[model samples]
Target: MHILVTNDDGPPSNQSSPYVHSFVRSLQAAGHTVSVVLPHIQRSWIGKAHIIGKTLIPSYFRPGTLHKDDGVASHHPFEDGKEEWVLIDGTPASCVQIGLWHLFQDRGPVDVVVSGPNYGRNTTALFSLSSGTIGGALEAAVCGKKAIALSYAFESREHDPEIIAAASQVSQKLIEKLTQDWPEDVHLYSINVPLRNNVAEAKILYTNVLQNRWTTGSSFEEAEVEEEVDPAEQEKEIREGERNGTNGADESSVARRKQKRFKWAPKFTDVHESVRAAGPGNDGWAVKEGIVSVTPLKANFCHVPNIKGEIKLSSKTSISGDQILASSSMPKLYAIIDYPDPYVQPLILSAIRSELKDLDVELISSVQQLPSPASPLLQYRDYESVDFEHALDQPRSSLLCAYVVRKALIRKHYLSNTISTWLVKHPQSPLKTHFKAAVNFELDYAEFLDEALVDAWDLNDSMTRNEARGNDNGNKEWWILKPGMGDGGNGIRLFSSMEQLQSIFEEWERDEENSGGEQEEEKEEKEKVHSPSSGNKVPTSASYGGTMTSQLRHFIAQPYIDPPLLLPSRENRKFHVRVYCLAVGALKVYVYKEMLALFAAKAYQLPSHLEVDLSCHLTNTCLQDGPSREGSVARYWDLEDTAHGPDWKEKVFEQICEATAAVFEAAAREQMVHFQTLPNAFEVFGIDFLVDSFLRAWLLEINAYPDFKQTGQQLQDPLIGGLFRQVMKVAVRPFFDKEAEDNDSQGSSEMRLVRDIDMGRR
Candidate 1:
């Protein structure tokens, strides 16, 4: 195997340590072609830094000759005429980076990269990440190669011959196992072993890096004792130095006595008993107890809440941003095409056409589409763990691609409505009632009578009858029932009486039972009646995007916006305007200039009876865009299709755009904070709005995943295709840039694709 061996402790000749030369010699004896590259000088705790402004020249330098004062006589002290030494005047990370790409470019891909026999132990979360020894190995892993960060733990800061032999022997055996068959899930292994004389057997322990946030303590101190020297010789030496005018070394004066001396240095804490109590195992504790510690690592970081099955943690300790950025110089980008939707096809093509052309968009059609399963709906909360520097480093099985795919979630509605309410509620927000069109309270079961809109008690003569019976109004009322999370108007019921609502409530009880949520009394209730089918026989009960079972636990009820302005062509047919809101990141929200106009199938009126029928209300395209009465489906209209003409369209559109813009700002403030990590996600919201007769647009609900297909004859726009083309430039490519990121500040946009909807971020 072509093995590349490197370390932070320069080389065997310059370093006082014997581990680097000894390990390389052992690998050569084991019948492997070992190549050597290391920092020109000792770069112990340099972390993962690379020269930013200057290019690195991987110059071949005679090892010990570079630092003559280290007392080594020859550069090739351990040379048996089988090894080559290459040096780069940079961090250990840069050594591995240049070694793989430049020095060994012609020798084919490296089989494995082994970094360090680092002079000191690299244990615990903070030190392991900060150690340059591990940084070099991590760089190799970032380059899609298996790597091990090896360290030697000694009782004192001394590398004895006995300790050197033990470290080399143990490390070579582990290297062989890694080359033959590595751990399936981990790409990088940080192996820290105890360096001791061979007196007994020492067991290898699997451990997790202990966690702690250490605040480095520092101060300067003065020496209290007086210096003693040869009196006559010191006087003569001082006189000679005074004659030469070089008395910088004199320490007898009061000013010299006051000179500052370092009392303490910055350091990270070890894996102690307190840390051991908190984990499956602790890496520092293993080394402290004379056992070799091996920790497994993975690439994924974000939380997967809506995964189809069990939620599994990818690793014990997630690799932080600095650790990922410290290693690997290559920058690449790949997208996971998790869906085969027609709208998604354009995006893959556009990403290929842009800077992401180097990447082949991975088309995911099944669970096996990727090397591992992907839950596209995962919230990008652990953004801090995603190393943008190594984002293109293809993870073995789990990966979060450039463009994220998410399902319409119930929390979307609550966030959108809650933010709008919150903004309107705050005096400092400067946002007015334009944001007050959604649910007025926090969503918890969306129960009735608690801030209930219109009570179904009005269905009966209950109020009038109670007044006649000399009774005061004190009873709770029913509300317009809608599923917590819904799309295309699947499970919607406008109940006129309390009995119809009671029946729907009983069915919710059954749904909770199936979901394993807290279930209520086992009350049998028939499926609520929906729109009339083509044959107009039994009412269809098919669920649309989400199953009926998932919707029962989460739902929201608002005052049914009644008596909406009608499309005069179909007299009293209530219609609502649907707009699109696109957010590439948190605090970056934009509203598409154009929108769709969808209307209900039947004429609008109050259902005075207890029997429920969805045909009259709920203007969802899936329900209303089917077969029409006059052999024509009616949905999605232009100004020419409506009787109000372009003037009315102009009047209502201003309010629609204004309300949507307000919702975007309010939602950003309320919802985006939860999603701190921005690189893993980009979303376009399907925002629905109702235009009241007052010409004001009321915020309805926000759909997390907007279905981009043409439902009816709305004629999907060509401009919508421009959206995907811009996403590569605006969102994905920026993560790859080496410069610092300020994506949240809202840069200028090409008006063709998206408009500036920045509402002055406070």
Candidate 2:
């Protein structure tokens, strides 16, 4: 596997730098192709700002590769022909872009992007905006790539060989585990190691970002001065100076004279005073108490509602967007396939039809045979005239269906009527309803497709340009592209750019337009080519042509939120609330049950300018010091441990539950309007939210599908089983009994009509 290594800390030098060469060599020793890209100058503290105009200029420097030096024990063994050096003039983020777009252009896709082995620990507040490390990892995540940012924490400036060795060992172990069993859809991981000689004894704790603060207080005062005179020297000096009338010996000498002494008094002011008052249970407190912290992060910042309600048939019904099913009455399932992944339409349709056994489920294809094993219950039906497969294969009607099928699905679900005939007889129906509907599923899909189109074009252009320039670090264009309809981060791509994607979209559009009355069978070939069955390679970069644009219609751009900086005056540090919800006893009961919260903090010196901002920044355990190069100083404050004494913890917990309940309410209402269904079943959503200094809560993204895997081996008796059982009870049960009854009656009527026709013939 090819490995791409990048960092925010410029390039490495011949002189000893623990991070650069050491990290590269380790990966190389593991038999991976390692490429390094870093800033030309330190771009530390500059969060996600891309070059707007003339700011971004390309500069080429020497490459830093493995070198054989006699002094360092970590040096590579002298190999006669191997050259080990590289240099690039770009920010750490730029390095990742270059490696993906240019350096490995011919080599196919890179396996992973690793940032750091940073000099200091990047935990809690520091993790969010630590450009020196986290920035690189974030760039990869945004581009839809699997990435990891690694750092080691030490007690002091002194380098401990044992700690270094231990960190290296852990890195290797983690890489092995992650490479073999990394979860799908997860793009990045932030890992921190404690600087202890006993790596085994040092606990590897998985924790959330702690909201804490460091103190910044100081003062200045005037010094006291005293003057004294020496008798013999003063008399002689005064006699000599008196001839010149320069205030010589005698009276002047006695007054001004002999010796002068000054006393300079310096006082130490506690800049961390405010932070100290924050009490405990923050990331800073944990780190101060000596514990390693690891926090999992997400790229998408949207909420995933447990349930949505919509007015349907004069009754209020709860629904979920994921539960929305497409009508099976349509003969042909229109699908877009760019890569090899065969469209899994058949499987999805099968799943839905299995759940709705009474409904008419038809499988139409231009191809004579079905792609998968035929379902006995879903009767594979044939249509006349139109060869949907052939039409799908043709470029004439491709793009149109990309729009048309989506339009059809939306109309069917919203109006509860099939729009195929309406679209033909009234060709302007789609136009009339275009963008009028508040909730459009196809629109979201289109948004993502458009972004992918742009990214694909940009990637191709950037690669071509980089190849021409022969600059190894100029390829920041390759990206991982994900489809909007895709879930669990599936249907991803390690694509080059927009040029390759335009043809695909154009073909899809053309097909839909030309195949106006074509039969489903004729269009099977075309549909098969673009189906999800064909394995799609994940794209490397999120941006196209270096422009920041959302690939998916409903997608969002994510920024790195630095973990809060924690001061060392407390016990445990870092804590986060994980609220869970369920529909119990038919009343839609949501609960904030379990919390995997912990205390942790980063060790960092605050700049002078950010002091006030730091205090007000609502120091959670997640954010570290902000930019304070001028007079401003970013301070860190802890949350007062009102929880332990006098019911503070319980009170805080109750408030968290209330806030989560509010979020659920908002989400449920929005979902209701969108899905037009009743909230009947139970769903367990892990909502992660952060609280500020004033105890004000800000919501992070909601995880619709939270992972059950534990970070450590600290599971107790019930552990995940209890949560799983609760979720399974709701997920397995059929939520829409009314719809099912309606379908059954309709089926019975059809059967009776057939029987009556037979009897009349007799």
Question: What do the candidate models score in CA lDDT, each in turn?
Answer: 0.51, 0.38
Over the full model, what C-alpha lDDT does candidate 2 score relative to the true structure? 0.38
Tens-place lDDT per residue, model 2, 58-137, is 44343343332232111232222122333345566767777778655543477778887665556555334534577787
- Residue 39 displacement (Å), model 2: 1.9
Models 1 onward score TM values of 0.40, 0.30
Q: Model 2 segments beyond 4 Å from truth?
A: 13-17, 54-85, 213-291, 300-762
Candidate 1 C-alpha error for residue 727, in Å: 3.6
- The residue pairs found clashing in candidate 1 are 484-554, 484-555
TM-score of model 2 relative to the true fold? 0.30
- 1-762 in candidate 1: lDDT tens per residue? 567888887766423334787676556443344668888777766776677887776555433422233323234322322125777778888888888887766444688898888876777765676778888887888888888889877554344666666567667666665455565567677778787775124677667777754432221223334544443444344323322323313333243545443322232222343344554457777776777777665422111122112112211111110111111343322233333354344333433344343332332233333343322211121233333333233222223332232322225456545455556566454235443333322222324533343532333453345335442222323235456555556456554333444445544444444543223211212222333233212122222212243344455544455557765666666767666655654335555555666666677755443333456566664543335332122333343434555577666656665655555555444544433323344555677777766656676667754655533211322334444444545545444442423552243343122334333421
Best candidate according to lDDT: 1
